[model samples]
Target: APAPTPTSTPTSTPTPPSHAGRVLLPHPDFRLFLAIDPRHGEVSRAMRNRGVEIFLLPPSLHDPDLISSSSPSSLSSSASSVGNGTATTATTATTTTTPNTPNTSTPPPPFHEEVRLLASQGLFGSSRRLRAAVVAAHARLAAACVRVHKRPPDLRELAHFAQLASTLACRGWPALAALVVAWRQIYLRSLGLGGADMVVGLRVLAQMVREAGVGSTLGVAG
Candidate 1:
């Protein structure tokens, strides 16, 4: 008998993400943070040239609740955790992850509860503000990578976010770092809290990037 020929399975081509509707403008302060000119056109090229291999801060390593919220199993887990208050007091940020839905397995880091304790120290108008700021830098990076592209990020975009994050996270951000350091000094003065306070520092990050403005602005709005 003749040897059987090997069969090849057909592979499907992945569809490219559509650049439809409108192109979103990247945030200005964020552009500066990455050293890209705030002006539009050739944005992607600029990012590549910047050689963005950034720092991944341990504090913002992974947001478990935000990551888990996207998981199908999260609802069930949340309900079950009701009996285990040990899980309840762990985190503070309530924002959604953009670009990439992070791996839920990457357990939330310790400061997950840091914001809550810092809240009572009278740093801001509300603790909610602190929470938002904590994740603010991460959120801006997500948008820059692809979330603001007028559609959900594809695998390629998500990968881009991860790269951008790693580079951005490792290197100290001048503006953001300075603010954090200054606030920490003030932290000693007012609250007598340690010089590692993140409340004010995080807020400075949030202020730099415009949240959700990418999709809303119609150049010809009446």
Candidate 2:
């Protein structure tokens, strides 16, 4: 009998052994930030914000202390007030009482609090999507590189392949997908999936550019 006909939805192809490479790479979230184009400045910024959020708040999902700690100056003032329970007034001499001065003593929110707020808002979701996208981009690039017997790809190159291939695959392009998958396979074989996990973020961005097609390229247009 002939092999059974395959019948899975087009959402995702079979993810070949994702564990091929064994080296520990950087946090996948961090790598995603590097893969986006600054030319798509807004998207790139969002991705970075999300990655930072995930790193800062992975386990707790929410930190109430951080929420209340946002206003650094106010919190400090409150603590001081509780400690001293008294106010000491100082005399001020002003040459020009007619002019009004702006208040510069207010402190900005704690930087980490801002980051936490951004993370809670799904800031890092796109970055995660980008990481998954690399699955396709690497495949295509590896095939092309192999045909030419080019140098082995780095994490950045692999990421570019995944970015390009996945974006194209989403748009109903099988040829592009095949190339991406093939290239990624080669990359995986060389380093083992686990090993590839430790690549830097910037390198991942370079890879995305390398594998980007016209649409994906345009997505990052300056």
Residue-level lDDT of model 2, residues 74-136, one tens digit each, is 322322111145644322222232223211122234444333432333322233222223332
What is the C-alpha lDDT profile of model 1 across 1-222, one tens digit per residue?
A: 999999999999987668646669868766445533222223576667866645433332244543323222222122221223453322323445443543112222333333322222222112232233333333333333242233322333322332332233234434234334433333223333222223322343344222211111111100
Which candidate's lDDT is highest? 2
Assess each prediction's global lDDT (C-alpha) against the native: 0.32, 0.37
Candidate 2 segments exceeding 4 Å error: 1-42, 46-51, 55-151, 175-222
Candidate whose TM-score is highest: 2
TM-score of each: 0.19, 0.20
